[model samples]
Target: MAGPALLLIALLLATLGQAPTARAEPNVHIYAAASLGDALDAAIARYEASHAVNIVPVYAASSTAARQIANGAPAELYFSANERWMTWLGEQGITLSERSDLLHNQLVLIAPRKDDASSVALDKPGELVARLGAGRRLAVGDPAHVPAGIYARQALQSLDEWQTLETRLARADNVRAALALVERGEAPLGIVYKTDARASNRVSELATFPAASHDPINYPLALVGTSPSDAASAFREWLAGEQALAIFQDFGFAAATSDAH
Candidate 1:
């Protein structure tokens, strides 16, 4: 009985001597536009497989993400769908590091996969309205703030269809939401990035908007704060590298050319 009691005491002492395991904190936090969701996820997974660092990403409209960063969100890096929001961050004195356009996308009109319309002539006035039929609305990101919505507005305006379609829009929080509306058949049609349309099998693209109709759809990436973590900087650099660009291209995004706006 004395030997058994001594053995139990020794086990208890050994347990107390062992330290508790510490939880690993994320080394980098990325705030990216909603449209980059799938591609960015793939890129992160591939990068993490080779590198020893923890990365966490937040996806939202560029406008919403920029506001969050401006309001003290813990974003080590920002990837915007357009230059406007990134410029806004700069105006706020956010101090972006290594800023450059990383990718380019195209605006396209899409509809539910069940819709038989293969292509629509966007240059013709009243054609979109005819396709919308009666009482149904066209889905689009909220033109008030979303970059995709803004581009959609520009394209419509350029095509001389804005007045007719402005009141017929089913506004959404972001481009992905607009795409979801078309995919779910909540709206008969939607305007979204080509990449967004490609991501969903439920939606079929109707037409690609002319590049001259709107501002170039550029995705700019930057280190958010003045002193970004070394891991964050490395990740930013890798994103512009060939490996990451290939992943983005596979997802239907084009590498941003120097001349791209």
Candidate 2:
């Protein structure tokens, strides 16, 4: 009875910002995909307002965060944009548990918001390459690692446009960084998530890639760390519930947990 009572007290203390003898972590650090930056930040704000424990978020490309986590980064959770990286983390035996898909997004081609730019036919080959304007470069997340870049590559390849645009690719660290390149007029074109284009005013949607062009876009959320804490698990539950769903929907993400594994 005393042992169980002590354990309960320790949990309460940790929730209140006090650590006990074990890995009594008082907060949850979330390493999320860059595309989720604004939505996740807003959700964290809402969660922290009512919850006692702090939920710190670290946003980056899923690839970047996963690589860092593999190197022993201290994040308590990892919410990735694609399943491949999440699976990679699982293969490395770094995930603590509760891996599941939470949201879905659409891939889009975006160009600087302009009045005279003609629309390109995304269903056909070479249309994207031909509309490259004077810049001739397309900003994309690093295809070798970033999920968005990988999807973009897949879409272009499916449309038989990869070879034409490969040389003009401006690889960015993450999807948001790629979007930033277009938003700042550094690149005339970019491939990004629909939510990203909605979040920015300087860029507008040019076309959306067909679903068959790439793998399904599922944002999987998992507790990832060698020493996972109760606070992290509890927060993960809250995030996966309807509370976070509403926030994600507002940012244009769809519910994709029907077949979460």
Candidate 3:
């Protein structure tokens, strides 16, 4: 009996010594484009279910998000709607070497559901301003920086409508805010990403501008230098996986090809 008890005590001590250690929760901060809100939320939700890390995402225009990360915002990952902003951040020494193209978006014309006769052709430029009744509003993201806004301006300029509608333009800081302005009926029409229009029930897509109208929309995701936690890198890895690509496709964003810019 004494021998058995001693053996049991030794075994218990050995088991205690071999016990697994608890893992520390990881902390992650991500800066993302406003256009990615829905898709990114879904991707993050799926990642959090399996990982012990908690991710905090800040959504803004691609340019604005780039500025924040470059200006010392504590972000571990940056997802921009356009590669220009991503390159800008890289030039400023804010991005890592191993970055991947995340997704692609198409700029589209959207109008309030109540606006009946405003359907424009996909290939033709939107003449929303000319079609508007008195006091009608035309919404566009700030063309100076917002990628969607820049595309919208290019389309308008190509169609020779830029000068005619210039006075009625209501500029929003980002595409989402411009979408909101149109959804609320404050603006009769807005230009935003196709994904954003799908996410909103209040607005309806009038048309999609031709791909030739402006530069391609590519969203490239990269790890910023200040990634305080490895979880950020893990999340970036998962974003390039099939699961995240499927989620992005479901949200109306195209899966970025390897050759995607």
Best by lDDT: 1
On TM-score, who's better, 2 or 3? 2
Root-mean-square deviation per candidate = 3.7, 8.1, 3.6
lDDT of 3 by residue, 67-158 (tens): 88879899888888988888988898764645767688898888887646457764444445555657776888898898788888887887
Worst 10 residues of 3 by lDDT: 122-131
Off by over 4 Å in 1: 1-26, 258-261
Indicate whether candidate 2 or candidate 3 has the larger lDDT.
2
Model 2 stretches astray by more than 4 angstroms: 1-25, 258-260
Worst 10 residues of 2 by lDDT: 18-27
lDDT of 2 by residue, 72-138 (tens): 8888899999899988987887855788888999999999999876667987655777788655799
Give the TM-scores of the predictions, in the order they appear.
Answer: 0.89, 0.87, 0.86
Global lDDT of each candidate: 0.92, 0.88, 0.83
Candidate 1 vs candidate 3: which has greater TM-score?
A: 1
Order the candidate numbers by lDDT, best to worst.
Answer: 1, 2, 3
